[model samples]
Target: MLAPSQAHILVIDDTPEAIRPLLLALRGRHWRVSVATDARQGQQRAQLLAPDLILLDVRMPGMDGFALCRLLQASPRTRDIPVLFLTSAGAADERLEGLSQGGVDYIMKTCEPAELLARVQIHLQLARRRAAAVDDTPAPPLSPDEVVLRAAMRLIGQQLAELPPLEAIAARVGTHDKKLSAIFRRHLGMTVFAWVREERLRRGRELLADPLLSMQEIAGSVGFRSACNFTTAFRERMGVTPSQYRKGLQDGAAGKGTPAG
Candidate 1:
């Protein structure tokens, strides 16, 4: 049996073609792996399996990546799991959006497989260290910056589905809207709206992986009012519609034969 500290990772992506190499690479390293194609199921798996880490894709049909990240961060059961976003969006602005949405790190889809694996290892190590510190320092308080960031992250994560306007988030964080925008730009390197859109796309991808939910239902659950709107946004960010993404996931699963339950 693999050691627990070897770390189990759940890869959540609507693009099965992109995920295949990542799955093979992590398994080769002797890390147990679980795959979820959509955000809702991914969230369910994270709660049930409590994987040590989550490898998340930023775009999908329904909830998108950022929304899923927020849900994970808000839920006590899964909040501590480290999330690393795997995305095709490699611009500096996109990277900042991913980080601001609660990702520990972001990996571009164009990254070499070896580099991706190395980054995963680094994130797992850091996660373990942070967990240890929390265990050892039971009474320690967060620094001012840490406190502010955590609070902001928590609110953002919870609201990713409903996604409040920038002014609302700024008010909650006890800052002027302009100051909040500047803070996100300065520290996270992206505008607040861009970060929110990235996160929504992330959660939508996760939701698209579920077979039980209809496209319309998934869209509504993830804050989209209509399937047309969801599909358009998904394609804009991910370069495919929800139906195509779902088909790819099904095809990949069929090719893999039976997966471990």
Candidate 2:
């Protein structure tokens, strides 16, 4: 792992006994480590702290870790935080679920303290590099396939309501999926799917400015499967519910019409 001089980490586990060895291992390592005893608190802390990495236990009371990880992925505020599963569940399906839910690594709690800390440090370092590259200022230069890129953007925007696959977008852009993915990543600093999601959320924000539109209509208009899904996605991306965003717009409009009172 990279130098741990200034990195911050969060551990979400139900068992206090399980956390002891980790705290011991991380002691004197100069990391800002915080713990949450359950998923709900873990989520709140994640949004507020924006820690670089999270060590989440798979099994917990109330919401389990898989669901919690999905919640993290849905929220734009904490979406990028790398989650390493501090779990004892060893089934292949369980591991698959963890990774699918956006966990970066899965480590059993029965392991030695050194192994635990080592995995934690490695993931934290990887996440640091990723955020650094993705958020780089003065983004990388565009490629010469300007025409194709324009075509692709137009296709995505036009079909956002349907939310077609990247392959479809590539096909419509007169290219293959691999090349399209490369171009998107090279020009946009993100994968094609990620950029599509970002664009959808951005467009959703614009649509939220219209008070006439219902949440279901807006969700459908932006290619979300349902209103509930849209709410989660919007909350994740904007750090607020869609209704709240619309209300803020209404509030701002009212403030503007107050006639300087």
Best by lDDT: 2
Error of 1 at 28 (Å): 0.5
Report lDDT (CA) for all predictions.
0.76, 0.78
List model 1 lDDT by residue over 189-209, tens digit each: 888777766777787788878
CA shift of 48, model 1, Å: 0.8
Using Cα atoms with residue i matched to residue i, what is each candidate's TM-score against the true structure? 0.53, 0.51
Cα error, candidate 1, residue 255 (Å) = 74
Return the lDDT, model 2, position 255: 92
The lDDT, on a scale of 0 to 1, for candidate 1 is 0.76
